[model samples]
Target: MAEPSLKRLQYFIALAEHGKFQLAADAVNISQPALSAELKRLEDFVGKPLFHRSPVTKLTAAGEALLPYAKSAVGAAHRFNEYAAAVNTGAPTSISIGTVATFLHRGLPQTITDFSAAHPDILVTTEEATSAAQSDMLLGHDIDIACGHMPLQHPGVICTPAARESFWLCAPTGSPITTIAEAVDSPFVIFRKSASPIYHDTVVGICRTHGFEPQIHHRTASWSAAVEMVAHGLGVSLVPSPVARNYHGDERLIFTRIGTRPNAPQAWITVRREDQSTLIGDLALGLVIASEALADPVAD
Candidate 1:
C-alpha cells in the first residue's frame, strides 16, 4: 500500500479529536461523505478499523494505537510545510494580525497601511477579536500577530511590550468628573464581561472599592456605539486613553483623568517567539514603534 497522504492523516487527526464524522467534517471544512470515505481509505491502508461507531464513537484498538502517531504526523507535516515555505520563499505572502476593536480607530489602520506600503509583496490582514480570543488565535496559528493590553502567557507564544496607555474617563465635553464617585453617577457605558475581563473587572472593582457600584446603562463591544451613546448623554465610560485620543476634537465627547487608576495596562504585541519569518517580525516591530509615539496621559 502507498504511504498515506497528508490530507488523509489530517482528517484522521481531526476525526479522532472530534469523535464524530459530521462534526469532524465541519471542522475540516469538507463534506461528511468525503471525510467518511477518506477515513475508510486510511483504515483500509492500515488494515484495521480505526473507529467503532456506536451511540458514542469509539476508537478501535488499531485506532487507539494510531491516534498519537496521527497527531504527531499532522503536526510534523505542518512544521515541514512551514520550514519548506521559509526555505522556498514562494510561500503565501501574507500576515494575519489580530486586535480588539478599540485599537482599530487609531493604532491598527496606520500601522497596517505603513507596513503594506513598505512590503507591498506581502498581504496584511487585520482581524478584530476579543482579548481572550487573540491569545487562542496566536496559539492555533490562526493569526500571525496580536496587539492588545493583556499579557501573552500562553506556552509557545512570546509577548513583547509594545506600549503603555493610561486609562481615562469618557464623557460629554466639559462634563465634571472630579472622582470615581461623580463618574459612577453618570450613565456608564461599559465593555461586556467578555470583551476584556481584566479591564472590565478593574473598572468595576475600582468603582466598588470607591463605595458604589456603577450604574451601567449600556454594554457593548463597539466603541463607536459607546461613544455615540455617550454623546447623546447616555453614559460615561472608562477606556484606554489611546482610544479616547482617537475621539479628540469631537464636540460631543469629553475625556477626563481617572483619579483611582493612574497607570495604564501595558499594550503588547504577541507572536510566536520562535517565528523566524522576516515579514512577521517587521510588522511586530512597526506596532511597537507606533505605540511608543502615542503614550501621553491626560493632564490632571
Candidate 2:
C-alpha cells in the first residue's frame, strides 16, 4: 500500500482539532463526503480505525496515538514553507495587515508607500477591521500585523504604542459648540462599540465626566461615517484628532479640541508575540514608528 499523503495528515489534524466532520471539512476547504473518504483511505493505510462516529466524535486508540505525529508533520510542513519563503527572492513575500478605516485615510497610505519603496519585492495586503477584530485576526494568523487603538490583552499578542492623540468634538459648521461640555444637550453620532470598543467607551466616559450621558442619535461602523453624519447636522460626535484632521478643509464640519483629559486614547501596532522577530513583522513596526514621527499631535 502507498504511504499516507501529507494532505491526509493535514485533514486528520483538522478533524482532530475540530472533532466534527463537517467543521473539519470546512476548515480544510473540502466537502464532508470527500473528507470522510480520505479519512477512510488513511485508516486503510494504517490498518486501524481512527475515529468513532458518535454524537460526539471520539478518537479511537489508534487515532490518539497518531495525533502527535500528525501535528508534528503539519507544523514541520508550515516551517518548511516559511523557510522557503524567506530564502526565495523570486517569489514576493506577503504580509497581511489589519487596520482601522481612519488610519487608511490619515497616515497609513503614506506609510505603505514608504515601505513599498524600501522593499519593492514585498507584497502587502490590507483589511479594514475593527479594533476588537484585529486582535482575533492576529491570533488566528489571518493578519501579520494590526494597527489600531490600544488595550489588546491576548496572551500571544504584543501591542506597541504607535502614536497618541486627543479626541476632538465634531459638529456641524455653524453649531455653537465651543466645548465638549456644551454639546451635552445635543444629539451625538457615536461609533458602534463593536467596531472600536476603546474609542466608544472613551467618548461615553468623557461625556459622563462632563455631567451627562450623551444622547446617541446614530451609531456608525466607521469614523468617517460618524463625521459625515455630524456634517449633515444629524448630530455631534467625538473623533480622534488625527481623523478630524483628514476633514480639515471640509466646509460642512468643525473640529473642537476637548479640554485636557486624564486618559487620551493611544494608537497601537499589534502582532503575535512570536512574530516580532520575523522580517515582515519587523518591517511593519519600523513603518509605524516612521509614520508616527511624521504626524503632528494636536496642540494642548
Best model number under lDDT: 2
Show pairs that collide, candidate 2.
none
Q: How accurate locally is residue 157 in candidate 2, as Cα lDDT from 0 to 100?
A: 68
- Candidate 2 lowest-lDDT run of ten: 291-300
Candidate models: Cα lDDT each: 0.75, 0.79
The digit string of per-residue lDDT tens for model 2 on 223-264 reads 888988988889999887677778888999988877654355
Query: Candidate 1: which pairs clash?
Result: 187-235, 187-236
